[model samples]
Target chain A: MNQKTNISQIAVVGTGVIGAGWIARCLAHGIQVIATDPAPDAEANLRKSLQQAWPSLEKTGISPGTSPEDLIFETDMAKAVEKADLIQENVPEVLELKHQVLGAISQACRKDAIIASSTSGITPSVLQQGCHCPERLLVAHPFNPVYLLPLVELVAGEKTEPAVLTRAESFYKEIGMKPLIVRREVEGHVADRLMEALWREALHIVNEDIATTEEIDAAIIYGAGLRWAQMGPFLTFHMAGGEAGMRHMLKQFGPALKLPWTKLEAPELTEDLKEKVINGCETHAGNKSVTALAAKRDEFLVEVLQLAEKYWPEPQSIMKK
Target chain B: MNQKTNISQIAVVGTGVIGAGWIARCLAHGIQVIATDPAPDAEANLRKSLQQAWPSLEKTGISPGTSPEDLIFETDMAKAVEKADLIQENVPEVLELKHQVLGAISQACRKDAIIASSTSGITPSVLQQGCHCPERLLVAHPFNPVYLLPLVELVAGEKTEPAVLTRAESFYKEIGMKPLIVRREVEGHVADRLMEALWREALHIVNEDIATTEEIDAAIIYGAGLRWAQMGPFLTFHMAGGEAGMRHMLKQFGPALKLPWTKLEAPELTEDLKEKVINGCETHAGNKSVTALAAKRDEFLVEVLQLAEKYWPEPQSIMKK
Candidate 1:
């Protein structure tokens, strides 16, 4: 059964970076958004963030009848979820907080309304623990600057129903998003776990002073990172193996895996390592602040993704495997 | 000592994909190239490859006085190396063949002429063995479509002189390439090691039937892979850590790494896995041939890199860190 009609409106709880981005995206897609946050100055700050992000969305061309003014700010939790077809919980990553927030939203929204959490680490099963209807609760994790990047991992908890996942996927697609459904509820889901592996190795490198932060980034931004933006490692190796393909590459390079090459054990983030890591990033930052760097990152991220869409066109066709 | 007066011309041996790419980039840079290969149709094939690659290179703005006619082909190894100031060897990965070709090229070129090998795995130390003026031998490994990607890992062997490395760096910079000088000899250098780690993990996923090749690619292209193009894992984590930074993230996520999240062992490439891998790529590739995909890849690569250059502006400035 289609639990709700069209996702004409969205309830966004916690107006932090992720939540605000979701609000901006929904509003741009012509969905009325009721966003709530208890923090002081939350309304003013969120409006600023939305104003900053709106231009990028405008470039992508927002839905008809959509405007930043479509966003409604609410401090009352019950009022926020009153008329939403879907509610996305973007509370802090603490489990108890998510449980409380998700429970409240589930109780207030339509009995059939789907509730999704943006928790990156905690499994949805745990977040749905005290909700009114756990079957309607699931995880829909989006990358930062959520308005830009299309990847959103949708993890259905053990209690979550299959229909909710299908409906959520369709709704996300409606909002111009690519939703990857993780079959199993592993910690960090699929994308974050993969990100964790490389991140840990990166920490080890900086910890031991094998390379400075700048050198490490250079190795990627110019080399393997370029290939990653368009394809994952498997298809790249298939291409790199010349005519013989992946089998030949595996046979020849398999032995190196056993080498003590990349450190899996993350070195302690001691004060010394912290200074080095921070300083290295500061140097790379040059004259810009983190905010400036983030602005620049958002700008490039959109351009690169647009180019990727133009080149690959149909990410879903590739995801069909 | 200045290794050579100037890099007026380059001698390219082996007309494989890597070699042809090198020729195209050089010709586009307005450098005269004496290219040699023994394959019966080497000239015709090289011309066809260059013709296909020219449009992309032209968009990058070809150098003044550079034309496709500048590529001179020779079947005779000594004649090819006679007038060149630099020799780039792209022979097959076999050790004996590399030794034979590099030694012959060294004997033919001027004593101070720099001879660089484009070996992906083999270390420069072994390639220098039995070569004339072994001090000039070094590994300048480049990514595929060598013309488009700015990364070139310059590895110095035991016998390679320090000044040769400096001169090579300057020469490559003048030609508009980013060369990363490896501090010590290592198999696969830095870039390939990172690529290999991710690749080995990808193979495991497919082998276990956890995900198809396309699914694996989707996990990356739409997710973490996008982050990689501009920032590596370290800085990205720095941002992900919120106001607390990398230490906070490491403390939060360190324990998850101990779990078997990503496979360290390279899965045996069984026939079943190979068929699955190949089939996934073919489907993703759709109606395009490998050559067609390569063309599409090249077009987007140049466009994306140009966009990246515009946003980042000075990869060299960042590389300075």
Candidate 2:
């Protein structure tokens, strides 16, 4: 499972925050990188960003021979991407701009080179529309601070080769990532949809003046946020379901789904939806009972609580700030 | 102000998961507890929960003089509330049942004793409608495994005295909790509203067959969840905005708010809302620059990623079981 990525050299197309992040991560993994950006000061900015991120990357253990100074900054996109095995495009999230940059990169890069987009919203199918060889294009969206967070959602375009996805998965894993292969193409993908939902609700909370942004932040940092660090909503609720797991939880809180708890209208809690949710959780829990899973959660929470106390900024005294 | 709560002796009504949690937390804080529930096996179940939680509580440090053995169980609600300084109710989340139980406890308890309901959906205003001494009742909702999570959203009713909310705040703070004083009463309070929004969207994802429960959980455990433990969404985005902070972020990604990203509809990103969010984050960031904050965030992520790797269950491979 820990097989090395055959991809030894890559080109990072764009030198913004996300592009710099990819450079830092790949450099830390000892992969050679050529980064290209059209902005006048992109090279200096990316260099500075790498300098800032290097210490942290080192703490996470940098690869043997890679250094920030080893990066190549090319003003010409074609020249930069020509020889690399993969080209990670992190340009701004506009469709026209992405199509334009991607079109140029696809023409220049090797035919077998993987063209991965860091787009948070656009689908890979949409992104691969006008590419030279669309079969090699895929969406490999990583979270912010890409040097650290391990998730990289891998979504294949309609024209993408299955082998391309398989290669991308191994390459991403080789660079210390957990690639979640999205089964369907949708706006915001999986993680961002969940995040955007919470973000929208949070914005509404702020709009209505129910709580300040600080208080809302405190609301998360102190409670659900701590647990989220270890488990997603499904597994967390599975443990909360007690001995019966999701079966009991859906029964108990299922009705509340209809309540005007959030502005987001919930799906009908039909028997089919209920079984899918329950079965999903039961399967995710595996050999562990709810109590056993809960014990592990509690142990994780105890340590994370301490870590949070140390890192979470001193919140403005409730509403008193 | 870490003032010791004036609440020394407390009553826990309805010895279910939440009530037992209250008992465990109280005992750990050295408070005297008398818990009451009419169910046949309530006491036995509560005792078992306490035993399971005690080891974790001990790791968080227990008050010297108090232990789980000091708890008293009474089947009669009147006897439970009569002598205690404060009574924490954790009954099932049914309106009529809450009104009936609260009506009874408000009448039987000491006139000066504070009554707090752990209702996740119903507001305190509705819960106090028919209760005797309604001014003493407020909503003090705690998350699951309440013994560990530090957040408690405190909402006061229309008839409740401001002084009672003041006391409740100090009391929850005294118990090693972060009490978020919700300014406006609404369904699900603050945190749960955010959580419910995410949960609903997650269900939609599963219903649409976008991803499995395991992949969804992996989406979070590896990425946003790690950051969430230390910084909530506002500050997280704040740092993502780079040098200009949230100000720059809104300019960059605010248009996406209008896109159909999540099932939930986002509020119009009006200029007023923009300033409020930007101001909120800027105030929260205080003297730190975005780089400084990102550095802190990176350091925390490095450690938390290690913690998560150790604790997060082995996720099933991407799309394959």
Highest-DockQ candidate: 2
What TM-scores do the predictions have? 0.76, 0.98
Query: Best TM-score goes to which candidate?
Result: 2
* Interface RMS for model 1: 14.8
Lowest-lDDT window of 10 residues in candidate 2 chain B?
A: B312-321
True contacts kept of 2: 0.84
Please compute DockQ, using alpha carbons, for every candidate against the native two-chain complex: 0.18, 0.71
Residue-level lDDT of model 1, residues A42-98, one tens digit each, is 999899878867766776668876778878899998999978888998887777777
User: Over the stretch B1-321, how does candidate 1's per-residue lDDT look in tens digits?
Assistant: 122438878999998878988998889887789999999999998998788667667765678777888899999989999888889999887789999998889888987889999998788998889688789989999886676666788989999999888788877766657787877676666777666556555444444444455555667766666656655555455445444444454456545556566643223334443333334333433464433433343355445645644553234331111
What lDDT tens digits, residue by residue, belong to model 2 across residues B1-321?
124557899999998888999899988998889999999999999999999999999999888877889999998899888998899999899999999999999989998999999988899989989698889999999999899998899999999999999898888877888888999999999999999999999999999999888788888878889988889999999887889999999998899999999999999999999999999999998888888888899889988887877787765544332
Model 1 spans > 4 angstroms off:
A1-5, A129-132, A242-321, B1-5, B38-41, B129-132, B241-321
Query: Model 2, clash count?
Result: 0
Candidate 2's C-alpha runs over 4 A off are A1-4, A315-321, B1-4, B315-321
> Per-residue lDDT of A167-223 in model 2, one digit per residue for the tens?
999899889888899999999999999999999999999999999999899898888
In terms of TM-score, how similar is model 2 to the real structure? 0.98
Question: What is the lDDT for A189 in model 2?
Answer: 96
